[model samples]
Target: MKDLEGKTVFITGGGGGIGGGIAQAFAERGTRIVLADIDQGFAQEEASRLPRSVEVMTLPLDVRSPESWKAARVEAEARFGAVDVLCNNAGISTGFRPLFDIPPEEFERVMAINVTGVYNGIQTFGPLMAARREGHIVNTSSMNGLTPFASFAAYSASKFAVLALSDALRDELAPQGVGVSTLFPGLTRSRMSQADLGKISAGDPARRAVIEANMMEPVWLGRAVVRAVEHDEPYIITHPDYREGLRARHERILAAFGDPAQPDYHTGMTATR
Candidate 1:
């Protein structure tokens, strides 16, 4: 995992935004890339723009579709000897709305892409990494996963699911020597904001303001992911400014519960039971 040079990275959402930035970062470092996106033309276009010497392949992928993931994996393995890394980065927002106000179909759609899509990526490629005993999986959660927002209930829920899944997978995959990294990114300049927010009703000014305030350049977040992979870091947080807020939230939770038992001090104890 430390050595990215010549490693093959299979990336979802590779057509544009954060995914494209990540692909370019790796490609610049001489890593081979397999670009998978919902839009086949965009995927191929991105692949075509990669450095001439870098090995690049493109696949039309609907992250929500298990069959698409299966085909993509098969093609990726066939094109490259084995995928050294898998980036589960494709996701969508449920247009800014309160939990009850959001349509059920919108919630379902967001969950399908944001949460279930990540699960599919892991289920499909996790075994291959386990067999090789040398691979990395990066699942992109969000800052909203760490801190709840009033307007983004569905998106927040899906991201929280991703965060929990990444934590569990890291421990599960440790014995197999495959690295699992979870990313909690603050707002990034991406299609999610443009497409999802643009679709929102014009009356929702508060939600629009919130989205605008959180925005950061996608390339910056992409570079952070590259560093996370290189360092084998378990959790990657893109925005440093959010640390104080996160700490305050943790403190509030601890105050309400009178301090949870420490794992190190409590031996042979299960939190679930």
Candidate 2:
């Protein structure tokens, strides 16, 4: 996993901000890349930005469909052999609306792409990587996944599921030499972020400007992702500013673990007369 030169990576959402950035970082490392997106044009456009010397492919992938996943695998493998890395970065947002106001179908759509899409990618590529005994899977979560607020509940839930899935999958894949990494990014420059900013700061131009200025360039996040895969790191936290709040949240959860519910029911003592 350390040396990524010549390795092949398949990235979902390759046409968009973070995915494009990740493709760029890996391309710079001389790794062959497959930019898979629902929008073929976006994937191709991202592929176009890479250095001419890098070997790359662009394919349309609807992460939600098993058929699409299989097709992508077939096409990418045909072009580059087995994929060495899978980036489950394709996702959608639930907007800045309250959970109650979100439509059921819209919420389902978000989960299908944001959560189940990752599941599909792993199912499609995890076995191949495991059998090969060398590969890395990077699943994109978010800072919201760590600290969910009222308005962002649905998106946060989907991302939280990503974290949970990656954690368990890491253990399951470790013996097979496959690595799983969870990427928790904060506010970054992307189509989703821009739309979120608009919803979050409707009339407040000053607030919108401040948030826009703080947005991290997607390439830097991509670079971090590349490093994480190389080192087989489990968790990649791109924004350190959220650490304090996360720590506090963890501390609160810890405070609730005092004792078992039934005081007289001690499992250590065998039930006998």
Candidate 3:
């Protein structure tokens, strides 16, 4: 992973703010890039920003579809050989609406694109990397995944699934020589984040400005991702300010571990049926 030069990196949602930042970070390391997105235009736009010397390709990829992933892999490998790194970063949010206010379809849509999309990517490319025994995977989770909040239930649930998927995949793939890392990003300037501005600021101009000012740059997260891949780190946390909140939540959960709620139950008992 330290030797990234000449490596081929494939990124889903390569058109978005964070994905573009990731592409840029890898491109800086002389890694060839495949910027795949459902909106091919956005992928191309990001590719155009890279230096001409960098080998970058843009493709239309709907991460929710396994067929789309297969086609993308075929085309990408045809152009630049097998992917050395895979960044499953494509996702959608359910906005900041309350859980009850959100429609069933909206919740399903978020889970489909945010959670299933990552799974599809993993299924498509993970085996190949495992066979090669030399590759890394970076799955984009969210700060909300670590610390959930009201009005963001569906989105938080989807991101939380990403963390679970990444963690399990890491354990399953590490022994096979493939590294997996989960990125828990906080508010970074993106189309999705901008769209939530009103709700986040509660229509207050000063609050809106302050929130905007505090938004992290997408490239910084990308840089952190790059470091994670290089070091084979399991978790990439870009926003440390939320650490206390996450710690508190964990402590609360841990405190609930009392007796198994049954007078005769023992901790080491194994199920026989």
Tens digit of per-residue lDDT, candidate 2, span 1-273: 499999999999999799999998998899999999999998999888999999999999999999999999999999999999999999999888899999999999999999999999999999988998989999999999898888989999999999999999999999999999999999899998999899989999999999999999999999999999999999999999999999999999999988789886666666331
Off by over 4 Å in 1: 196-214, 259-273
- Candidate 2 versus the native: TM-score? 0.95
Q: Which ten residues in a row have the lowest lDDT in candidate 2?
A: 264-273
Per-residue lDDT tens digits for candidate 1, residues 1-273, read 397899999999898778887888888778999989999888888778778998999999999999999999889888888888899999887777779998888888989999999999999999989998989999999889998778888889999999999999999999999999998887677777667666772678888788777778776777788888888899988888888889999999887874347644645566760
Pairing residues by index, what is the TM-score of model 1?
A: 0.88
Off by over 4 Å in 3: 267-273
My TM-score estimates for the predictions, one after another, are 0.88, 0.95, 0.95
Model 3 residue 75 CA deviation in Å:
0.7
TM-score of 3: 0.95
| Total clashes for model 2 | 0
RMSD (CA, Å), candidate 3 to true, equals: 2.6
Instruction: Name the better of 1 and 2 by TM-score.
Output: 2
lDDT by residue for model 3 (1-273), tens: 478999999999899789999998998899999999999999999999999999999999998899999999999999999898999999888788889998899888889899999999999889999999989999999999999999899999999999999988998998899999999999998878888887677759998998899999998999999999999999999999999999999999999988777898777757441
Candidate 1 RMSD computed on C-alpha atoms after optimal superposition onto the true structure: 4.0
